[model samples]
Target: NDKLKFTIRGSYINNLTSKNSRVNLNTGVTWFAGKGWTVNFLNTSSFHRVTNNTGSSSFTSSYFELGINKSFDIQQPRHKYYNYTAVFYKDLNGNRIHDANEPGVSDVLAEIIRANPEQDLKDKNYNGEFLSNELYSNDKGKIEYDNIVEGVYNIKYIPKDIQNAHYESEGTEKQFVAKKDTVMYIPFMERNKLFGKISLHRTQHSALGDIPLGNIKITVEGNDKTYSALTDKEGYFEMYIPVSDYYKVKINNIFREHFTLRQESYIIKFNGYKRFELSFDFDEKARKIHFDESDFLITDEEENGNVSFEDIKVIKQTNLRGIVKDANSLLPIHAIVSIFNNKTGELISETASSRRTGVYFTSFFAGDSYTIKVKAQGYWTYTEDLYLNQITTFDNVNRDILLRKTYIDEEIKTENLRFKSGNSELSALAKAELDNLVSTLFLNPDIIIEIGGHTDDMEALSVNAKQLSEMRAKAVADYMKQRGLSEKRMKIRALSNHDPKSRLDTPEGRAQNRRVSIIIAGF
Candidate 1:
């Protein structure tokens, strides 16, 4: 009887089976590789052993078979992303773009910066500092940048080794974005395209070309920038400015042909694509610009409106006359008279008087209010308000005004003199009046005056006269000396108890006796 036992062994096989006199074992292994590749190995083994080994001579039989198989999971290729590029060239001259064969060409530095679309782009130099990652242009005045993300970018260019060369191109900043793969071009041009002609015409149909207005500097300021140009031989000048906001133009010259003919400044709103013609008319004789009368129109007219000849009725044209005098003495006071419109408060005229007669005259329209203000040295200011509502024809309005003389002393019967009670010290108010007197003497240079002191009859004649008169007279002399007044221009005298202007029996009379007087000696 022949019986058999089967056993199978392998790294990947855990069990073996046999049927119909044949056995098969399954085994497999897997390995991983880079780039998404995989490898696998499998094997099958079978073995037969004599079960009735009683014979001990039974033979063992084994069968093995190797099979190979391959399977692959394919993968697709990935797409590559591309970036945008920007290139530019700067022309150092003002003649638009650079010529191919131009000589003495200098290098220009430029930088390309990526700007985040979600954020606003700002120049790093705003805080007066330079930032990193700024690119510079090549020696050929060329700049290029690439691998820029899909967003905005700014290109900045600066000229190298060029001094005093004018530029009219867009400044260092060029704003652009790379929505898709794109190539951007930025060209910088020079600013030397300024040229223009100017002609002047007079109302007399004469050309004033002979008037030499040498290189008048004309400045155009706009968009946080300023540009200057000079007037040419034909009184014409042209200036080139970067394309930006409107420009404010101003002209300046040495000679003012007319008070209004000085360079006029205006806004030039037009773009620089076309030529602009500006005509200037100057009247040298009248020193004024002959503008169309229609330009000066009165838009509003009311009873109390501003002074406009066409707005109100001139019921009468009168020369108003007035005299300013000391309110207490009715004596004329020399002063400066300033007249103004009461409604508009505009000073219409002013005049100064040489003599003590404070008289002034000016023309005014009827039914108008006028204010006259008088200002004099050492005198309180006097102001008068007048309403001319009655005069219907050309007439003279006599308005006399009396200004109160500012006195250091009122009871003392003396002109421009003051004193402390029972003492020779001059009061502050008295010193102020004396200061004016001293100024007058200095101005005249040849004027002289007598300083006199007086006393009342209450004291003994000889003793009171000597003491009181001497003290008072010495006080005046000392004041003059302190004020830089030459002693040669003054003389002192003490009248003592003599020449009393008031009665000795009354208190007012005694007060008047204690006084001092300034008598003008000569001019």
Candidate 2:
């Protein structure tokens, strides 16, 4: 009602000499919009009459007018309001981009400090350090402060106040000029990188022979939480974790079954803000040691902040080195080299001859007799026995090998080449007989042969007879494959009890029937 205006007016005049009378009427309406704007309309009407001269004549005229009006009221301006917004969010994927699926963090308290004032006028109560109040983020993770004066300011948050230990802020403080509404984004990432290496301690006697265990899983557990990392090609694993009182670090259980850890799990007390490095190894004679906190801790006495594992004494490796070549052509041969301890009858180490260089090397303890076997495709396997006495130095012992080439088809059958009852694994006698055949197959690469598997009729049911025969043939084929023979050069046949090398009436004949025979099919 205050924005609208209305007016009405009337006037009357009388002439005494001419006896004439006049009348006028006017009406107007005005509407006021905000900020000095108005719309107005007016109407006017007039009537006149002469009584003596014109004997009563009357006329009336009316007109309407419409208009819009604006008024500028110049007054002293009030303080303009500006806003500062801080957006707090977690960087879930570590890409640094705030995705729509990622949720915003709430209740984050941020403080604002004015770096510069709009005017040089400094009040005695004004301090440069902080504002009067702290801003808190709402459920949408937006910390907003309004009615801020135009000035340069800083927004900051304390790391300890975040409450989430696993996350570290990307930016601790942000400086901006709040001439208008301003928005700043703060992201947090996983904190505390833990890195270490995994190795295999071959033996206490061979300190320089440790092998890096690559592509293995290492896990870290602390405060009812677990984190894991996969070793790279260099057997190094790294992960980020939260600050905890203590942590238990260990390798995969599959590795534990194969090799023994001196300490199954390592426990370390850790604090925040520092990265740590450690190493571990699996050994055959690694006895279960008591958990010594000092053994896996970084003390102030240490110059570097690295957690040290047991220091392995360095020792020189007694290596065996050689080259394998064709006996006739004198050409290099890529071969599989293996060493076995003569006294213990155990394999010491295995290596391969370089395809281009035909060079191979392996390490072992001295003062023991060892047998070296070199096998290659298209060449006969070479075997030799040598003794490294106590006088042998740490220097490599060089012994070259020459393999014979074969061009003829040869089949050697032995009754001792038999599998154990109800099993497909090759026994010592079977392996010894097959080793000779492996060389022949390797020496002559063009020879394709049929491996005939057979079983005795001792089983009451022949249900597993064919399967067992097939497995036995596969076992022989797999062995040759390991010894550097191609599968394409060999064919398998499961003959079962149908084919026999000897009569089945006697026990000795049955033993002979359970043998596998290798027959050359073609060149």
Candidate 3:
């Protein structure tokens, strides 16, 4: 074996005045002496000249140096010739170093250590008695050492007045006790089994690919213990982890996106090994969508017996029935029916369809006013107020709902009316109806309706007809006027003692005779 020595040198110069010529020179030498003490020499020079004869000048400079070096012996003698190399840039003029300062800069720091500090011995000096080395950086922040042994070493740098350096070294070659066999014991009580599969498909055809992604890291976190595994080429991953009260798995893709799945925190009590599988699909355009435990088939014990099929069949058989139809045509019409509590406004049931024959049959409790709102996509929603007191007996209630198709051309009809007996005064219910009429009229100013009054056969023909008809007609006109209906479009007429639609023989028939009507005379 020989003691090897090497030297490097360099220089540069720039001429700022006239012609501005620059020159640089570098040279080095190496020597090997059989006795270990190797000596070497180096030199560098620079010269600059102004080509303009008006004020021409030239300057030159050179450096000379010598050094001696030797090797160290340690128990791990294989590292005797080991060395490290580093390059750094000085913040000269607030910028890093350049070629001009090479071979002359001195004292920059360089540190090398076994990445696994537990296995490598620690030391404070350059005795070479142990597993690491630290060398000062040069003025130009560059240093080199050669012949280091094969091992993973972390390199750190301490820049003058800058932050401390950090790095990571990887690979099994850095492990000491290479010939020692190590075993890890996983007790049955502490083991957990997790199974999952990932699928990658084409965005356009949804075609699956056989190409699998191996080395995908899956981490399970439980009881502060993190278990990691690499997926197989088929995108399947399974591993036994330490049983913890709570657990979650994190999947990280090669593209840097991550997905996490959480599990309930409870002891799994089973006769055999507990296993679960998670399946998911991946789209190139949409990335990955993780499927949770609910997406997989799993079983749990129920302390109480499960409900029987026969019981469920009986429950479904007793539901109420209903049919929805168009009011004007008596034809079935598809509609969305949402049953809500009239007082609370909470929904009790809902159904929808798009065909002409819309039928809904659902259950409900008695003694509540239920509001059924029916809406077809493009049609106005129709609401009906119904009191369920009629079905308190628990018998099946058959309801036939007639939904009027909302027409853009049709205005509200106001023919239904009831008046106080033998008086011109309007009833409270009539006043409310008249308010609605007023709103309709304001919405469509072109609409016109004739208000007509009639009476039943009573008193003398002339007096009974005149008083009954005039009072009824004037009562309706007064109500419309109070509700902001324009007098120009509303026409009041009293056919009092003249027209009689019913006889006065019975109270029901007589009540129907005292009424007012609104006819759509023109639009």
Best by lDDT: 2
Clashing pairs in 2: 379-443
Model 1: how far residue 140 lies from native, Å:
3.9
- After superposition, the stretches of candidate 3 with alpha carbons farther than 4 Å from their true spots are 1-323, 327-330, 335-352, 359-370, 375-400, 404-422, 427-450, 456-470, 480-491, 503-513, 518-523
Writing each residue's lDDT as its tens digit, candidate 1 over 295-314 gives 56645663356655674343
Across residues 420-510, which tens digit of lDDT does each residue of candidate 3 receive?
A: 4666677777787888777655645666777788776653343567766877887787778877887888777887645555765776776
TM-score of each: 0.27, 0.28, 0.25
> Whose TM-score is higher: candidate 1's or candidate 2's?
2
- Ranking the candidates on TM-score from highest down gives 2, 1, 3
lDDT (Cα, tens digit) per residue for candidate 2, span 1-523:
8999899999999998888899999999999888899999999999988787547888899999999888874422443447778777766655666778767777677788775564324744443433546777777778888767556777877543555456766557878887677887777655777888876766554433333344467888876767788787687888776556678998874344336776667887655445878887766554333657865565776637343444632333466777788888887788989888878879977887756556666666654578887877655567787765545346567878999764434455565668666778888877777787777555456678888788988841645898888888899888878887888888899988998878757887788888788877766
lDDT of each: 0.57, 0.72, 0.55
Best by TM-score: 2
Better of 1 and 3 by lDDT: 1
Flag regions of model 1 displaced more than 4 Å: 1-85, 90-106, 114-132, 161-163, 193-281, 285-344, 347-523
Taking every candidate in turn, the Cα RMSD to the unseen true structure, in Å, is 28.3, 24.8, 27.0
